[model samples]
Target chain A: MENTALEKSVLNKRKTKSLILRFMVWLCGILTVGILAYILLFILVRGIPNINMEFLFGEYNSDSLSAFSSIVTTVEMIVISLIIAVPVGVFCAIYLHEYAKRGNKAVKVIRLAVDTLAGIPSIVYGLFGMIFFVNILGLRASVLSGVLTISIMILPVIISSSEEAIKSVPDMYREGSLGLGATRLRTVFSIVLPTAMPGILSGVILAIGRIVGETAALIFTSGTNVLENPTLDLMASQRTLAIHMYMLASEGLPYSKDMAFATGAILIIIVFIVNFAATKLAGRIGGLSNGK
Target chain B: MESIKKSKFNDTVMQSVFFMSAFVSVLAVIAISLFLFLRGIPAIAEIGFMDFVFSEKWGPVNTPASYGILSMIVGSIYVTAGAIVIGVPVGLMCAVFLAEFCPEGIYKIVKPAVNLLAGIPSIIYGFFGMQIVVPFVRDNVGGNGYSILSASIILGIMILPTIISISESSIRAVPESYKEGSFGLGATKEETIFKVVVPAAKSGVLTAIILGIGRAVGETMAVVMVAGNAVMPLDKIALLKPIRTLTTNIVTEMSYASGLHESSLIATGVVLFVFIVILNASLSLIKFRSSRN
Candidate 1:
């Protein structure tokens, strides 16, 4: 009887609760992937067929320019914001990761500051952009305002990611460069930066994705009117694709609904391509670093 | 000798360059705080604190227009709470699966899918919610499709990436020794995970939830699209009812608003700023405590 009881307990060791738990986990995992697939396929199915050159580049009235200009504005925002943000962010990372002494109070404060900056909601950034850039600084609801605002919004992200990249440059590389009579500055610029370029580029890609997709912060700062004739005037208000999508949808104009979907589809495609590349690059970095 | 001198000079110049660059972040934060206060406070003062925050009459276009944001505040809270309810369980489950249950081949696909979710822009999510969830709500649940329910569903989906990624990392950070010990003690795998492993990662999971709330609360474009954005009484609750959040309030009205109305919107931003700051402080405190432990 005792032997039979032991066998029965052993047979029942894979409990029903465990089975249920396993099922739930799988259900959730599949559910998450399902939701993602649904969103992508749904949007693409509706958005892709609508996308045409006319939809993309043509103006509402033939007299004015079209969704094409929003694309232009997005590019301008990306370029201008990155130009301002990248160097400063990289240098700040350098100071934190390399120059600052370990366990220092100042470094700790700065580290906390970056985290705080990261947590602050993007809408708050919008208000700051409006008050400081658009009003006080007289940027006047232009591309310049959007650039300045987005630069700040992306700063903490760039700093944190770039710091991680810089940190991954093994101490031996830095020591070897310095031991070869290279100045500290020379070691960072010539050796460390080059080796860390892939990682930094991946961070920049992420930042670009963010800049392209952002709408709310840019709404007040950039202002949502697409320029009639695209020019190099950073002072002129222009729409981004995301803002265009928002405006078109919110207005509930029957004619513009398909255009909004097409724009969303285009936006999704761009973001997807960039994201896929970043993951591949990150994977490569992992392999390279592991090999080293 | 000349080269050595030049190298020393380069170090000084680059060092200062780094200093100034780092200072830019600090200066920017200070400027944001300064400007928000400088612009936002006077508007609140002019409106009166009780009147600004307590009254629900937000019709700035009406005769003797009012600027109270109580309804918007309630709308934000309701939407955020609903998101937390909808998002946290699914996200936490997905995190646990990824951290422990996922097979290698499945892991690769699952991981990228989560990243893709994160990468998809907010506006697209807004569009998706507007197209799908909004209509579903309107049809099935009654009332206009653009309700708190619609915003909640979208925000819920949007916060999944944040919650899953952070919670997964925290679960992974749990020491292998603890799990092994649980196994040796004859705990079932589910028992070990639920009773031991998940508890060990409790603070981290809490951090994830908090961060998710922050994301949901701050979200503007998506919420504006789905939430009906009506200024209504807070005492009566309806899932299918239209309501305005603080974000949509500012975004919707700012374009047409002028004079005191504009300032009131900036003041609305000030209230949001305070909410976010409090959330950040709590999140960091949690992190600090967890690190100490």
Candidate 2:
């Protein structure tokens, strides 16, 4: 009878322990999801009401603080940065995957540099851009300086993702091209790159998202001077959308709070679209590369 | 054979182009390091390294300006520790839940949610902190809205995606054999996970934590918005009071600062850069040792 009683108590303790652990895990999961939902809902609910046609396209007066100029600057930053970064990044990835030996010293050094660059803070990038691009290079805190700084910033993202995509291309395709007496360059360009295009494009989209969302790196390099009219003279000092929202929040003009919310809403919407597209591309890449 | 010779020449040119492109990142790293040290070390030398790093006074405008950043260092450490404290356990549990417990339907919702969290810009996070977290802390936890505690909470939230995704993948990577052996020994699922799987995935979890630290320490705009940017003496620093960090020190003063004041800020950037290099080195060390094992 005493033995039976002890076994019953031991079983009960084990059951209780399992129950508590399960409860805690579930609680953490719920909390994680809940936080994201709350932040998204809170911003969208308050922000969507304030965004109208004028808010999107009007000039930034003391009363209105429109985002039209900032929007144009944002697009220009994205385009210029990509044009400079994409070819360089794609070529880097191709070299890593196709040209370098597995344990080559240069390959190792390149990987380390990429990792270190990615780890460096955006704020540090901002400071470097300020000192080097803005002052030393005599760009003088223009959009061009910001573009140069972020192009370096987003290179690792592009290189790593593009490498992954390139690495996934079946060797059979390469072997066949060479079998047909095609030059290695021709094979890579015609067969491998096209096959990896969806993956590479997805990575480019992710880099775009990073550029769109960056703030600290742009503030000093780009300078937060708002243009009265939309212009794309790379020399002109401008603020991107993230910086615009940051300035609005920090300066806190009377209507700035409402305008900040509107800006935040717009930023979130862009991110959602970017994330959705990247996810879709990633899904498509799986089917394309594997099915072939 | 003229066409063949032309193709060979073209290939040689493209290969060199690719090699040059590949070398750019290495050149960038060397250039960044050289530039930062060249510009930043002068101020450190002028101020004296011991006085700059160890002293707490940060008066850049005083007649005899003090350029010490000890308080900011302390502030960075405190908030990062606070973030790790608040974010790690919850994130670990969430990772385990996703890897071990969540059904397919819920995983679909939770996975995208985490990605969205990662994608949200820091500026938006700053605004969120300003509008929401500051007021909540002001009312509930004491002190003014902008406090170290407020920064900690926001950073903790900001780092969740990094910690969760890395930890979840690591947890999933643990071998099925270990779990099977645990189950064969009459261990419960929870016991098997915490004891068997988690212990196995410790290095990866550790990597996640180190990366989270990197993210939290390097974070600036969100922290600046919430962390009241008060340059405090070492003794006066507290959780509910405002504080400055190394990154914030540079950003707040960079606009108008010139001469030594500006250089001192750059020196602060040097300090931040050192901390990041150390973190990155340690992370690589962890990865190397783990792979070897």
TM-scores of the models, in the order given: 0.96, 0.99
lDDT of 1 by residue, A1-292 (tens): 9999997787576587788898998889999999999999888888898888866776555332257788888888899999999999999988888788889787777777777778777788888999899998888999999999999989897898788778778788889998998888999999877777777888888999999889889999998887665666899998887898887777676567877777888888998998988877656556655646
| Interface RMSD values, listed in order for every candidate | 1.0, 0.8
lDDT per model vs. reference: 0.87, 0.92
Label model 1 with its docking quality class.
Answer: medium
Task: Give the per-residue lDDT digits (tens) of candidate 2, residues A1-292.
Answer: 9999999899889989999999999999999999999898888988899999888998777667889999999999999999999999999999999888889999999999999998999999998898899989999989999999999999998898889999889889999999999998999899889988888998899999999999999999998999777899999999999998999999876578888998999999999999999888877778876765
RMSD of each: 2.2, 1.0
> How close to the true structure is residue A106 of candidate 2, measured as C-alpha lDDT?
94
Residue B281 lDDT (model 2): 97
What DockQ number belongs to candidate 2?
0.84
Q: Every model's DockQ, to 2 decimals? A: 0.78, 0.84
Model 2, residue B255: C-alpha shift (Å): 1.1
lDDT of 2 by residue, B1-293 (tens): 99999998999999999989998999888878888888999999999999999999889999889999999999999989989998999899999999999999999999899888999999888889988999999999899989999999999998899999999999999999999999999989999999899999999999999999999999999999999999988888999999999988888888899999999998999999999999999999999999899
